[model samples]
Target: MTGLRYVYAVCRPFDAPLQAQLTGVADDPPRLLPHGDLVAVVSHVPEADFSEEALRAHLENLDWLTATARAHQQVVDALTVVTTPLPLRLATVFRDDSGVRQMLEEREAAFRRTLDRLNGRVEWGVKVFVETERTEQAGSEPAQPAPKPASGRDYLRQRRRQSRTNEDLWSRAEEFASGLHTALAGRADDARLHAPQNPRLSGAAGRNVLNAAYLVSRDTSEEFVEMVDRTKDDAPGIRVELTGPWAAYSFAGDETGRGEADEERHGESGGESGEEKTGEES
Candidate 1:
């Protein structure tokens, strides 16, 4: 394959071979480029599409970005199964083999440090959605119409009551999320709380109150999963989600000099944000 080189991840050498038909971005099969003790996982892509000027235009298109991120993620996922991988930002491209080697050389120390920290660990994503009152009331009961407000004063009073109720629900949700994060953090080696996810992007119902990633050792992952399960039903109107055993993307740190647009790839699920498929898929 000939063109610009798209680098997917950096990791230590491993004996395990990638899946025979595993294809990366631009439909090119990935190859390992070893630099010192670190290996850069790279594949070729058309310069017309991957070059700096071309990428700036393509990234504006969501369809193109999503496809690229998914393909990039597939390579990272494969690496994760065999060994811990330090995932680079989406759309990381280089001019050629020498450029790729220079990157590995430049970032060697940082890569080794992050890889060592994430060696046997994986990332687990936890999200909590609070059910809205309208959602809860669906198909339950039809309430009698309230008498028309006697005056503007009464109308204002009614509005205040509704506002307070909404505030109370949100407060409760925040409190629950705080407690849950505390409990989960107790079990995880490290934890990060990202901004609440947008419902439009997540496609999950209700209000997203918690978007967090926890780093846990492989041996205790099962116990960590159970810990999340036990809290799923703890709050009446709160919903909990768990995704992972994925490569520690959230904990990998930004050694790649990733742009702001690239950072958007990690919305709620660390690396798989804005994706519809479950973590187990691909």
Candidate 2:
């Protein structure tokens, strides 16, 4: 098949081996694209599948997008075992090695700065959710109002009670989410808050009150985790889950150098011409 280079990440040159049995798009094993003192983790893909034209179509296809994201993440995860990888966006393709080298040349200084900040660091994702459903053993006592109110007075009373209850629930949720994030961020090198996820979108059983990412050095990972655990008892009805030790996806800056996920191609010859990236979708 014709060659199209798919880049997973950029890192300082290392002597260790990449994770064995790892493959990226098209089931092709990723290889290194080293320029100067830096190395790029890359793999080959079919020209038609990864080209600019094809990407526009493939990105809109859910099945194709899912497969590509999984493959891309697999490669980045493997690299983390040996080095701190600054992850690129999914479907970041170039014509060949020359393009990859050009990216390194243009972004070399910025890459070094980010690497220095992230050298021994890995990203941790913390999601705080509030349980909306009562436990199974609550004995099924009226999920909602059992019967219509007998009078307007009763209806007004019920409505007043509900409004107060809702106000309390949301007030507590806001405080709980804020406190949890503050505690975690205290122990991390840096932290960022992402948009709160919807229940249907996250497929989580409860409302996602807090969605944040923390950049913690590898040596302090356990300390950060332990801190997260301690915060749980302080906030009872809230469910706190910790994920990762992952590559620094959320912390990595995107195009325009603003550190966000811009969904367009953004590379050129100028010093500011940069790569665009976002945190993991999987």
Candidate 3:
């Protein structure tokens, strides 16, 4: 149970208040480590649990991972209330405060550039789903029936109709997804498209055609949300789901958490997303 520092976020110094009992990973309250004008939010973690080897095993446990992500988001949410936060990907750790300081110094310029770019802005998530509708329409006609064909003619025609309908829906879904991206991007400062999430992973069904994130300004967040809402009526069969005013997780420099060097340091895997940090640390 040797101690290690679990780093949460980096930002310029601020005097705003945090919750009296703000704890990060494993129920450890976070504290700040300052380097020049920058500060890193960090917490003490037990190496037995956070060490690279331990994280690799623990991250595979859904309950642990979910709880950890919740705790991480809790901290990020708190910071968002106070200042512009550049959140580190999940499970970002260094051996000690000195190591954290050195890393901060090394990344200081890049960090500042990102913080400046993201100032007065927050990240929002958008996901689009298309429900299954049983119907046929014009423009995508089914193949003509084979003239006096064999035994399964009726069944084959039915299957072909279903297949054509699916193809048509897919085509429409693509156009809708692209249009949503374009429309949303126009409203926000920047946008990114991620792979559509799986139903099992996202806990929703139909088809996830668009998984995207936008960096919207603080003053225009309502406008952004409203615009996302407005997009719903634009596509008849598609559902555009919006979630956020979140910290800029997608805009973080290394979208895949930290690089191999960090993982190699702890002999663990990197975080899958900024929201989910599960892995061992040094």
Best by TM-score: 1
Ranking by TM-score: 1, 2, 3
TM-scores of all candidate predictions against the true structure = 0.84, 0.83, 0.81
lDDT per residue for candidate 1 within 1-282, as digits (tens), equals: 678888888999999999889999999999999988999999988988876667767766767877887788888889988888888877777878898898888878888889999988988888888787542343447545556899999999988876876677778888999999999999999998887887666567889888898999999999999999998877766788898777777788885323233334335423333332111100
lDDT of 1: 0.78
Ranking by lDDT: 1, 3, 2
Instruction: Report lDDT per candidate.
Output: 0.78, 0.72, 0.76
Relative to the true structure, candidate 1 reaches a TM of: 0.84
List model 3 lDDT by residue over 1-282, tens digit each. 348998889988999878898888888898889999999999988888888778877767766776776787788889988999898877887898888898888888999899998898998888888765523423256545435535587778867877887777778988998888898899899997776666654457678788788989999999889888887866556677888787787787762263222222112333453334544333
Error of 3 at 191 (Å): 1.0
Better of 2 and 3 by TM-score: 2
Positional deviation of residue 136's Cα in model 2 after best superposition, in angstroms: 12
TM match of model 2 to true structure = 0.83
Clashing pairs in 3: 50-281, 51-280, 51-281, 52-280, 52-281, 55-279, 55-280, 90-277
Candidate 3 residue 131 Cα shift, in angstroms, is 0.7
